[model samples]
Target: MPTNGGQIKTYAAPEGVAVADAFLIYARSVDSEPWIPVSTYAVDVAEVNTTRNEFDKHPISVASFDMDGPVEVQVKYTLNKVQSAAIRPKSLGIQAVIDGDNTITFSLDRPRDVMLEINHDKWQALHILTNGIDHNALPSDSQETWYFGPGINNGSPYGLVTDGNLFVPSNTMVYLAGGAFVTFKLNFIKVCNSGVRGHGFIYNGPNGGAILIERSENIVVENVTSLGATGFSLTTGEAKGVTISGYRSFSSHGNGDGVDLFCSSDILVENCFLRNSDDTIAIYGHRWDYYGDSSNIVIRNCTLLPDIAHPIHMGTHGNPAKPETISGIHISNIDILDHYENQMWYQGCISLSAGDENLIEDVHIQDVRVERISKGQLVNMRVMKNEMWTTAPGHGIRNVTLKNISLDATNSQIVNPSQILGFDYTRKVENIVFENLNIGGQYIHDGMGKPRWYMVADLVPMFINEHVTNVKFILTK
Candidate 1:
């Protein structure tokens, strides 16, 4: 119901949509406000999953921005119905069909308050469809993305006897009936030595998507560490007064997003470490299954190590494709040690290419360092570049700044043109200043064909047709 309409739209998820304890919503800044700041930008916003009841568990982590030093915030999940089960993420379907609708909703209380963030990998995941979900009306175009599916082999023999209780090893090979294991497969991460091998933390095959909270508020996630074999976790939904900090998350073999915010607002994440296979952090504008954008988010002083993909990112194509952009998110003072190890699987360090149809504005990435990176190392702005191929009605990436960046890499350049044509086509980068920024070594970015070397020195500051200015870096050789 964004009556002050420009190009964004919001909708509610249907009734009876099943969801767990965690959910996420990601958004990007739109409009040309190079100096206006995210909190002050004028734009459209929305939330997701407005049908089910939400349970705000005390977040395992909590931290505060706006003030110096480490300040603690009490975390809680806004709850509706109490089912003795622990909180978990909801499963989603692949976008292989034209109307492949798969989503959940969370009804909420008016008093819940939560904070927000984004997960770009989830946005990327939301874009392409899986084979099981693939029912496309048109034949494959050469430019179409490859489609996978909700890969799961639930009935396969994947258990073992441990301490008298049945245990599930991560990579237990299972036999599928018709076809092959590839079709009904559940892949596992090959953790070196100290992988997640505990109770309630087994590789639960596949069919996993997300956990959610709806219209939740006044929650805190503090001092929690639940990494490896974990999927989407520690969420606040459509609530105010939220905080997530001093926590650590591990990665699993499949899609694992840490600390998501959906249809929520006024959230903060600080002093945390995220190690997962997908997007470490994320926020959104709104979804058909849910409604709301991440607002007033401050993620600072954290360590992000996505076991598979980007350590930090935001905005999903579904949001912008609906002509709705994620908004008002800030990420700062973080260290990301990327292990881009999943090549045949994952991608990117930080990707901004959610969709070009909506507004992607007021994103501030400052004082960040990538301690280590591989070939397919850093960001992609593909979503904001192309119009015909993607969704979103009218959009641009403005007032986004990447300042005070220092990284230790092999061949990673600070920024580039090939992977991130979005900053090239839509807006002029202003105050996108980078000072005292360092880049080490060089390599090729894996998925989107972007380079991972200190290439920003080459592509940025292009006094050109469009990307005349940018998240520029002023450094010493």
Candidate 2:
């Protein structure tokens, strides 16, 4: 759909792909132009921990496109059924021009991923994913690039025999062009200076990870969309010097983490959108054959929506005998859309539940906006032994700082308080600070006007359990 100054490109799903009838979507460059029909695909959501009930499935919709610039959009839902409509983060302040009770119109200037809800329905919202044109996409005829053009591409030519897995060798660049649907586990093992880029979708359904990087360095996976993976979508274990930018992932199956790193270091994950049934991004010390400390990771400018678990979870798995350390993590400029978890112990948007004799320290989270928390806590920093996932208690969680963290609970529900606890006297959580923590338009600090006997957590409504020391909230402008 090309206009005078702006253009839009849409991808058709493969044959046998399911299309959604819940909404009709269209796009145009301006108000005077004719609207082009956008393909709306049905994606599974809330299908974990259950028997795939239709009522509980939700059957979310996604409309994606590549745009050159700003564009106008419209969405039409069931007539007279929608009493309300909203688009979030809520910080974006994207107002919809409601046309009666069934249609809404909006404008998008920048490429972003947004959720559109009807009648305040949280589970069955439509995701509008807009991406810019891939200017650095390699040509199809390049010798260094192995290109998969538009269509359903299996891994027959790339050594996919019986396992439904495709291994990309070292020093190679694999490009999945627009409208290409790849159906295999793309693995990069022991490779250097390799990458997989372009505007394509990797659909590895009900199997292992969508893209796995193990024992590899100097690798990048950018601007690629992955959906319907049963395990982690994009994972790195025992790998280093990796960058994942402009990536998108969606999953509904059990243990469907967005970007999980185990025993890895020096990673940068930015400008990504992840909506999953488990943690959106988890950083751990050691797991499986990946044995070492996880350090120097930066995750910024990403949107995370966790339907069943935490958004940013870390320090849960490590070596119990050697006592590994997970340190030097910085997470900033994040927009957490929604977090819903029923289990009390496993419900936090930012959780650092250290276990398996791991020592987690020197972590910082700043400039984050949390829009909705349906049934979870804002933060959970604990060092305890959980028999379900860990064998021993952690050493401690220390030297953590959170700055300019804001949560908007005006139109949402928060059922639990944030927790900070430690295991015993020997293992304590210390040196924690919260600067400019805002909740419901109020900054929670130490000098707030409250009763003299009230602690700082009383204002923020947090729980400072035993063995936690040196926790302070400062009013930093």
- On residues 84-190, what C-alpha lDDT tens digit does candidate 2 reach at each position? 78887677888877887588898898788888988777665888888787777665746566787766772234454247777887888889877777878888999
Per-model TM-score on C-alpha atoms: 0.48, 0.94
RMSD of each: 23.4, 2.4
- Clashes (backbone N, CA, C under 3 Å), per candidate, total 100, 0
Report lDDT per candidate.
0.39, 0.84
Model 2: lDDT equals 0.84
Model 1 per-residue lDDT tens digits across residues 252-341: 544467776654567788876565656778665564465555567888877675545567656653454345556677888776654354
lDDT of 1 at 446: 17
Model 2 TM: 0.94
Model 1: weakest 10-residue lDDT segment is 37-46
